[model samples]
Target: MHRDTASQRLHGDLIGQPGSRDRLNTPALILDADAFARNVARMADFARRHGLILRPHAKSHKSADIARAQLASGAVGLCCAKLGEAEALAAEGIDGLHLTSPVVTPPGIARLAALARRIAALSIVADHPDVVDALAVAAQGGPPLTVFVDIDPGIHRTGVASPQEAVALARRIADHPSLRYGGVQFYCGAQQHIQDFAERRAAIVERTDYLSTCLAALTAADLAPAIVTGGGTGSHVIDAELGVLTELQVGSYIFMDREYSDCDLGDGGAKPFETALLVDAGVISANAPGLVTIDAGLKAFATDTGPPAILAGAGESARYRFMGDEHGAVIGPDLPGIGARITLGTPHCDPTVNLYDAYHVIRGDVLTAIWPVTARGRSA
Candidate 1:
């Protein structure tokens, strides 16, 4: 086992001491410690009140420290997008890790089996018979592998197409002695950001109805799943109300991004979770009037959703435009002079987080801690 003292020393060196946030380098990812704590508590309380299992997706933050905080806040487990991510968290002693995506390749299955032996409980998703067979063969002499049937809820990404397909896959998993059928993973990745509350609810209702059909088929075949896990930060409330989702895999709630902020929460109010994640960029040049250039550009934050929003400093009202790979332009009146710092909120948290090496954790303008992005490049 990894030593606790060694881990503390390494984190201590990475974080150093709590002091002014200005002392840190520019264009770094910063986490508001207070806001982060509040977000964790809020999500945990919501899950507890609704009687839903909270399995926050680690793909959003990818920091073991953040995962520990979520687990401490009453999360049942952590969900990862890839085997490398699961391996990184497992190395830090995070048990109950579940891979949200399916693994069908022989080499990936072999690595996952190896990780299963080390962790207390590891689960993965499957939408095809080939993946089921490969996983069963991989777990021949190892411990029983838990598997969830991936149900494509209108996303058509990677899951079984129909209820009949889901039942057949569940039966095949049960037939394998090395595999234990966990449940169904019905996630609508595209529906999460629907701007209208009624639209979001309609999308989830349609998906949940399909899920109920799969559940009934599974029960008829005497393969009733013990867990029905699928729901994101956007539709957790709706999923809980439908009475089908046993656990919620909401990840981005910990760090609200501009895309989530733009989404309606079924109510004309702000998101319950605070915007805890920010990118600190410094004014590199103020050569032009009413315009200042920052060091962060397309490379600093994810541009697929949109440009990053200025959260603090003189650039709050400024319009952010991508200047180049290494630079961004903030155009507005009374822009900050050269060397001044500004906080930028990412358009999307997950991919934006992948760009950073560590989080400069802060509490009231003082850098309190630094958590390494342990799973930053764990896409393999």
Candidate 2:
């Protein structure tokens, strides 16, 4: 893995180089600045129109610059996937940070307590009393840390299974010495892109109903949830209209990927966000007929959602297949010859982004800026 030194070291600057789009940069990540700005604005407007607080997830971009732009465009704050991510963003003075995942270790909890002293409001999620107890001990006399109960809502991920479990966890958080019960998180990650509108809606309805029940239980126990957070780019509209999610935590809306493009929001149109992020690679070899190879392969993108879509140059039916560690194979009728450049639309933006060191921000064919993936290796 290439350590991201673009933020510190000055290698060949890819952003301002001549023939940037045409030059073959091996396994480089690209971002369309215009498209990214548009996506951010659209999501911000959507939040404003529906009276919902937008706390975009930083786990997608992992760049302080992108987080700053979201904040400037009226985002309430940022949501990170881990305590390390929160620490990285807090180092950049990002206030109102929320750690979406449960963090239970002593060192992790200690870091969270230290961060709570500087930021406006720092929060995290938990699904059990053990984690809450650990966090309470860590924040014994430090600043009060706002803790949220994570509800599974059929995802069966890192959250409590039912309303009863959520209520029990909330009570534990409330009773803990250093933890304050902030609210509940009901993010159904699996149902984010179900492809079918009715299926997606049904999934969200079930999750929302579960969240409502949890909230009711919390209230009955005199522990009214102050913040109800969950939802992604695909379910933002539904979550907003349902009027249950106090704050929407959509991340990938700022850079729509091939996966989200396949999701029909029942609007008879493509996703309302722009395709901002792309992987720029060079055609390294033309070994066979109807086949061309590029320098971006499994190392350039995550294979969990399959290979990326081959955009730019030649045909609409160009297929991107993983070749090996650092190469991608494309097959199409009009696939260009050797040394040709291409922009691949990532299958999954978040994990694919984590594979890159820096993003080459571009305006049309002109390279403009470079932003480091600040929290790139922050997986703790």
The number of the candidate with the highest TM-score is 1
Misplaced by over 4 Å in model 1 are 1-19
Scored by CA lDDT, what does every candidate get? 0.88, 0.84
**Index of the highest-lDDT prediction:** 1
Error of 1 at 121 (Å): 0.1
| Candidate 1: Cα lDDT at 5 | 37
**45-138, model 2: which lDDT tens digit per residue?**
9999998989999999998889999999999899999888888878877888999998877788777888888787888999888888888888
True-vs-predicted CA distance for residue 227, candidate 1, Å: 0.6
Which residue pairs show backbone clashes in model 2? none
| Global fold similarity of model 1 (TM-score) | 0.95
Clash count in backbone of candidate 2: 0
RMSD of 2: 2.4
- C-alpha displacement of 27 in model 1, angstroms? 0.6
